[model samples]
Target: MATLRRYDLDWLRVIAILAVYLHHVGMPFNGDDFHIMNTDSSKLLDDMMVFFEQFRLPLLFLISGTGTIFAFSKRTWIQFTKERAVRLLVPLFFGVLIIVPPQTYFEHINEYASYFEVYKNADFGINHLWFIENLFWISLAVIPLILFLKSSKSNRLLCFFEQITAKKFGVFFGVLPLILILISSKKYFPSDSKDILNLSSTFYYGFFFVMGILFASAEGTWIHLKQFRKLNAVLFIISTIVFYAYYFMPSEWISPYLTINQRWNLWYIVCCLVGWTFVTTLLGYAQIWFNKKSVLVQKLNEAIYPFYILHQTVLIVLAYYIIQFELNIPLKMLLLLVTSFPIIILIYRFLVYPFKITRVLFGMKKRV
Candidate 1:
């Protein structure tokens, strides 16, 4: 079978990364204790953040898994592993050593007079690059499995999955395994985002990564997704309403807090359902309508990885200053959004794109 080139996946990747940027910028405005904060905060922003938390990273991990299948198509398994290490780890190390300290400095500057102080006392932690750290390990963990899939012995198993993807509604099975993972994570690890070692998210994100692999490797998935697009959209809308209602509406009958020890809760179940539906609906729509290409899409796609690596640091620094102006929430968010993009773009274009060493450090391809 011929490998498909998915421009839609590229588009979604760009959108997801931008959404992360927006999410982080919204963090301080929403009263989350991020590296920086605007003086103005909003309950409305908090609600939006909760909704975004349900799906954003999951979508990216799924996309990463699909991209992995395509990437391996062009290289040997060992080659792929090395590439993932360089692509993921190099940027992670660079971010830890260079990019992240500014955020931490701003975060602790009143306590510590210098960036060097923050650097010395701080653990050289991955910070936002925790995503990269988790991804690197997850990629390594999946290699043996991918190697097994590559062998002729796995042909029958592959065929079995392919057959399922060919069925009209069978793609829904992808969400079932994820539910188990989410439940396990919620019960044990409980998703402390600040804890880089949180096994909960590792297992949770790894599930979506596997889902992407299945989607890419299975036959007829694209057709099935398109065929079920309308249903997926309806399900997405319904799930969104249910999620928001349960999440935002306060009533004596309903409690939003979920505990894994309880065996199951409506919040956990709805989150899994909504997460999968949002992904399905987005993927189906993108594949159907966004497969066509544009120059801007190509540029954004190339810029995305580096932008993700650099965006938060830039945002935190800019937000530190922007918040000092005492602007309302909308204008602060708008100003940060408008200002940060160009600065990030300029840095990527001038500093990252032109140099061979910087390219590798930032997870870009070496200059050809």
Candidate 2:
């Protein structure tokens, strides 16, 4: 039942890291999703994108929150804050100013935007590194509350949340308003770095990270998820399909209400609930099925952080070439994915493993 047990975290990290890699590079054979659409069946890949999209950020939030509970419990507030800032904030700053700008510069230079313009533009820094910024910002924003809350009775907040989530009806009603809010402000809700001005993501989605830290205190929950293995497996598959079906239908056709209203508030909540539950539950089951002691899980868990930071840059490089060559979307995607794996491994071997950048960038330790 140990939450941070090597295997469980390893499995989740592998799932997250690979899912993210796929998100950027896309499925190996998916070509229609390229900037230039074609008559290929790669529409299915786009469908897959919608289905898997819900869980990537959310699962990451849960994993981080779960780890934070363990981490914060062992350290003083100052220690925890310093650790988080060092790990996330420092990297975010560097990513914006140094590590990320070259690629940003390269990608947008042809678009007639000035360097000054790019610097001034809020979204210009580290296009895909938004997660690191948000993670740091959310952690910093929530620490005071976390310190205050954690100082009180250990189980008081948890019991309160348990009381809320314990009820089937409460889950529906509690998430319904957030859904409405997201739908109302769909253009805003953490869609990009610019959305920081929109308070909903800060208050709603950011709060989920807080809940992740709080609720994940119970590594025992994995056991509960495991207990429901057979049932959850069926539900996960069905929900994944339902999630994809939404993407296949044009938004105009499926929900004129959403398009006219221009909000993801309703569907976001509904999908998030189903998505969060199934993804974590399935991961828990995977922890069991993959037997946690496997070598592959261990290596992947170690590589994921660097993989995350480095993959997008690699993906963009490949994306440009694929488009330039006018290759079939599926074939190009396949070639790009094949090319990316060796490049990612090589980068990790040099910049991270030998250079030992984890201490400076990702707040992680060596294991692989």
Candidate 3:
């Protein structure tokens, strides 16, 4: 068979990264503790962020997992490992050393006198680049599993997945494992701090990564997703509404019936449903609508990784200054979004994309 290119996945990855960029831009105004905060916060933005937060990172990881199948198709295990390291680690190191410190400096501008001082004393942490760090390690961790799934030895496991996907409700069955994992681990890992060292987060994201591999490994999985796209979409919408309703309801309303632990468990189950449904829904729709190749998609596919790496740093630096102006939250957000996006693109176009060293450092494939 000729190599299958998933243009839908390309589009989804680009879109997901852009959503993350938007999320970051809205961060300072979302009433959340961030590198910088607007003097006033937006309840609307906070609620919207909370809703999107349910599925955004999980969707990205799932897409990454699916893309891994394609990546592994052409290369041997060792070559695949080396490529992942270069693509993930090089930018991670560069971000930690060169890009991330400025955000930290701005966060502690009163305590720190200069950017150089912050860089010198910068703790060895990944910060927002934690996603890259997690992906690198998850890629390495799953190598053996991917190899086995590709080999004949894994027929039983693949067959089970095949059977599952063939059923009427099989696509939704993907959420069961995630639910079980979250429910079981909730006591130990209460919240995802987005730290690479957080085992809970690692496991949480790793589950989606592995799910992607399994979805790709079993033939007919995408067909099943497309077939049930409508149902998944409905579930996603319902779950999202239910999630926000439950999230915003007064605690006293629930305090009469459920204990705190029980309430949290219920919330986790809802979150799992919401996250998985949204992911499958998008996958299904992408298969139907976005599978066709496009020049724009190809260009974005090339540029998005570098864009992801460079985005948070640029946003934080800009927001650090933008939030200081005597402006309302909306105006500040508009300024940050409008200004930061083009700056990132220009930096990528003029500086990162044109040079081999910058491309490699930003995790783009070097030009031929």
lDDT (Cα atoms) of all candidates against the true structure? 0.82, 0.62, 0.87
lDDT of 3 by residue, 74-174 (tens): 99999999999888899999998888887887788898777788756755457789899889889989999989988999899888887888787888877
Better of 1 and 2 by lDDT: 1
- Candidate 1 local distance difference test against the native: 0.82
Off by over 4 Å in 3: none
Q: How does candidate 2 score on lDDT?
A: 0.62
Query: Counting only residues 3 or more apart in sequence or on different chains, how many pairs clash (N, Cα, C under 3 Å) in candidate 1?
Result: 0
* Top-down TM-score ranking: 3, 1, 2
Q: Which candidate is the best by TM-score?
A: 3
Q: How well does candidate 3 score on lDDT at residue 359? A: 88
> How do the residues 65-126 of candidate 2 rate in per-residue lDDT, one tens digit apiece?
66666667668878988888887777677667755655565566576466565567754455
> Which clashing pairs does model 3 show?
none
If scored against the real structure, what TM-score would every candidate get?
A: 0.93, 0.77, 0.97
Query: Residue 366 in model 2: shift from native, Å?
Result: 7.1
> Candidate 3: RMSD over Cα atoms?
1.4
Q: Provide the lowest-lDDT 10-residue window in model 3.
A: 118-127
